[model samples]
Target: MGKKRLVSLLLAAVMLLMAACSVNMGEDEPKTTTDPGTKGTETKSGAQKVVFWHAMGGATTKVVDQLVDNFNKSQDKIQVEAVYQGTYDDLLSKLKASMGTSEGPTVVQMYEIGSRFMIDSKLITPMQNFIDQDKWDVGQLEPNISGYYTFDDKLYSMPFNTSNPILYYNKDLFKEAGLDPENPPKTFEELKTAADKISKTGKAVGANFAIYGWFMEQFFANQGAEYVNNGNGRDDLATESLVNSEAGVKVMTWWKDLIDSKAANNLGRKTDDSKKAFSAGQVAMILDSTAALKGLVDGTAGKFEVGTGFLPKPADAKEGGVIVGGASLWMMNNRPDEEQKAAWEFIKFLTSPEQQAFWHINTGYFPITTKAYEQDSVKENLKKFPQFQTAIDQLHNTKLNRATQGAVMGVFPEARQIVEGAIEEVLNNKKTPKAALDDAAKEITSKIQEYNRTVK
Candidate 1:
């Protein structure tokens, strides 16, 4: 069969499967309750109640709950119930299982890696549909934040919590190594020289980063290289991995050299462990997500002066950028018109300047719109925690290209694992950078082909 015909057939199959599945929140009455403060009168008023499944928990959950409460109070015609559904992976699985059913949430918060799958699932109401229907002007949003979800000149989802990678350094450690704390490294070459100096003191590891595929992906993007073919999978479906290219070689070689010199610590693949090592001052520098700034700051408060900087680039890199790492809100299509409209209204409220600023202040996530930075609450938070501004500047300085736009593949998480496995092999001296990455690329290409064949 032709590719497009195959795709259409696969979509139809997915729709049928979705219709057969349903979601149950928990054992107790479906665990899908309306707003608590509604006093059991919201349904009596014939108000549209929308369910929103999200992955945020702990302190972030508190913010989400508060926002939902506010949204409930602001309007009597609609009420939104936010459900905490474990991690992003868990949320995606549940969403898929509940697709096209009444048990399905009206809206979902999907991570960046799941964008391609969600787009092809044929289960979502494109945010563009509502935007155009309401004649909404979304020009206030940051281009880079919205760019990832925009395909074929239309937005597929609403950009919500967003962040990028950055470098976090200990100022005291830099001074102890006889390096100027104010003058941080801008390139990997400079970072190596500084790391060597810091390591000589034996007080702390020079630097550390988790063995994460996303970090490695950022390096490829910073070198102005594509991670996959077909314009980073924007122009068409990606067919193969380009991570074995010269740019990938340069990045991996530098990483291996850093480990060999004992200036870098490989904390396996756990991001939390790397963050803890840095926050405890065991490592002088670390690479982490912008969303971790609040915890890092709070953990290191009164212990040391923390410094933040952009992710280091390669010396020869000319034009490069960092891609966003966060989740976005998507509305489901298999729902009543009232439910969809209510879900869209809830999404709009969540992305408003006031709410975005509140979320940014509480979670340390970069605000999705420019107007959020102008809010009084955000301004006050920036004054107290200036490190948050570095990530914003780093994102603004990024070049807008296919590389920075990031890769969109149906099996992105698996591709990330393949790359991480390659990095581990190179670190353990099992293979050269080229050999490890070449092997990984071959495996990833196979996965891509298999996924496309199944979906198409």
Candidate 2:
């Protein structure tokens, strides 16, 4: 059988098994009830110490520490200790090794995709109960953010440091190329033309991207294609994937071309390396998480300048919506109920509009709440960097479609590796775009089946 036929057949078998298998997240009734304004458990006089593990570094980390201090001083009941626990993968390893050992922190920052393993392990407690008991109404929060924490119909974590990808460029390079720095590319053909012009300048080598997987997702989502099935992404609320399709293949092929022409340098298999190259002005345009802007500007400091723009689209592409990235706060199990209460306080504090405004200013992240944007302090901060609106505009332009359901497969990082390898083949001229992605789809499907086998 051909690779396509074999993969389609494999998908059929897996779909059949999926139909036969049934897994329940939890019971039907809500687990905990609430009481208004009552202090149930009191460790009077001395505040409870809640240690939180996160991946933020430098300026971002400093701001979190200040928030912790602000929260501690605001109330007499909780004291939060925030720790810079290596990277996301690093925290995953630490979290796994320390399981049931009783030596780990009370709360940890987990990337959205990695939350599932912890959720399944029963290592992290559902936080809704605590919120409910505290008489908190979650309905008041942003709906888009709720999915990030809701797993199995319950809240397992708190959304923090959330960000979506956007296009970044060096304006100086654009001017040198004789292209309007203010007139950023709005469609695919224009993007191609602008890139070619910028590359000719030799001041910087054309456009490059840090997160190819994320770039593919935004490119397709903007076209109204689904990356995965379960509700636009692995929101932990959806039940399927959408990685194999015509639109998906098209998006992959697009990136494969960039890799092929060396238009964008290899992300070098390491995000830091690509980021360094961009900051050093080795690459003219890049698509990276907006969360990196503050650092990029900080690193470039007087050497060159940076500019922001929305992702360009193909002429036929539909509106776009990207799966959110960064990390969320998962409340770990094993801590006493009182400790969980303290942790709940920390979660609420981190997400408040006042703190959100402070954080957006300090770290250059988009505000999570509508109110944050309207704040006077936020208004003043907006002048220096009007590009903050770029993220909002990007989010607003998104339209719901099958293409927007961002793909979520188990062992996502591994699946990404398979995808990266497939693109490598295209870039290296080993095969045509169609053939490369067809083989990639087959390999991806096989891995999905393998992951499914381990699940049950």
Candidate 3:
């Protein structure tokens, strides 16, 4: 062979190797296409990929994972990836940072108070759009639960895990204090009386209500009081805070008086701490979400009998109901049409009667759909935990009103923090209840105004 022939053969071999490398690299890369709708990347299997960010932790996380796995395995057209994003606050913070970017989730499970902020962000495709497009029956869901997420006759999000506040008391302590074990306190005065009597028995503190801001909101609603103006921020955007109104004064006064009279103990702001105290029999009564029922029951098993009752109100306060407290699933508009539709499918699966029944029984959160009650599993679970009946009855007995509908404000998360700080101030004797609440209301109103300006 000649020298020129050898050099040409070597050059051709080098070129062929480079071409092979390029082809391999192309195959290894993800197959993604950018469209006008920001459609997500398709998997190698040709399935649409949907990312779901949720705040569910502990055992509930396992349930969520299992549900997602089931959905992924049930079909091959779409695949969902569930990611735990710490607390709801953490998730929202990350979401805010990821807005207008591909890093954000296709679906996010945000706490109920974040509804106004989510809507104002204009980043989400209102769940109502999908419902209307599909001609789905919205009536199948619990009206009370749906009412919270509905604004201007539109549903912005799908209610996933729904709950409300309830009073959990140790029936044995009531009996020991010479009070009726079966009849729990229904009014604030009665609660105070019971707390005083139970505390005097030396069994445990009469009550240990956590200094959580959510409790303050619920208390206001229980008194048929709106937390903000503009019809609880439902009729229109709320411009002011009503946290220092007459109803607010009554709640703060009664709460402070209870602690001052040694009828109840303030357990700081962490609800988990108070729940642990109750489970350890260190407190006779406590206020908590209905969602905690299962954990509380199991934690106190074989130790004491737990009795549940309605959230108490001022004796003279007209009959008002508790507000629904929980999170919802939001579909982001930044996702592609196919990905958004896939996320919607997952949302529907999560709210289905069977899935909702399982979720309710396992987590103690109310199934957003009323049809879940018809499931045998739900019925059996209710029979096993009769105390849960109070939650159901309370939800049904609640009249649909502005107070019960709950407040909506873009600054709700910040407002909650402010309210929590004011509560701590009052509890620590650093300020008068009126003074602290007034300051909090002012701060919250200012934040709301800022949010409004930014959105506009």
lDDT of 1 by residue, 420-452 (tens): 889999999999999999999999898778778
Taking all chains together, the TM-score of candidate 1 against the true structure is: 0.91
lDDT of 3: 0.82
Local distance difference test, each candidate:
0.82, 0.65, 0.82
Off by over 4 Å in 2: 1-45, 134-140, 151-154, 201-203, 229-244, 258-267, 298-305, 400-405
Clash pairs detected, candidate 3? none
Clash totals, every prediction: 0, 14, 0
TM-score of 2: 0.80
Against the hidden true structure, what lDDT does model 1 obtain? 0.82
Q: How well does candidate 3 score on lDDT at residue 426?
A: 88
Q: What are the models' TM-scores?
A: 0.91, 0.80, 0.88
> Which residue pairs show collisions in model 1?
none
Rank by TM-score, highest first: 1, 3, 2
Q: Which of 2 and 3 is the better model by lDDT?
A: 3
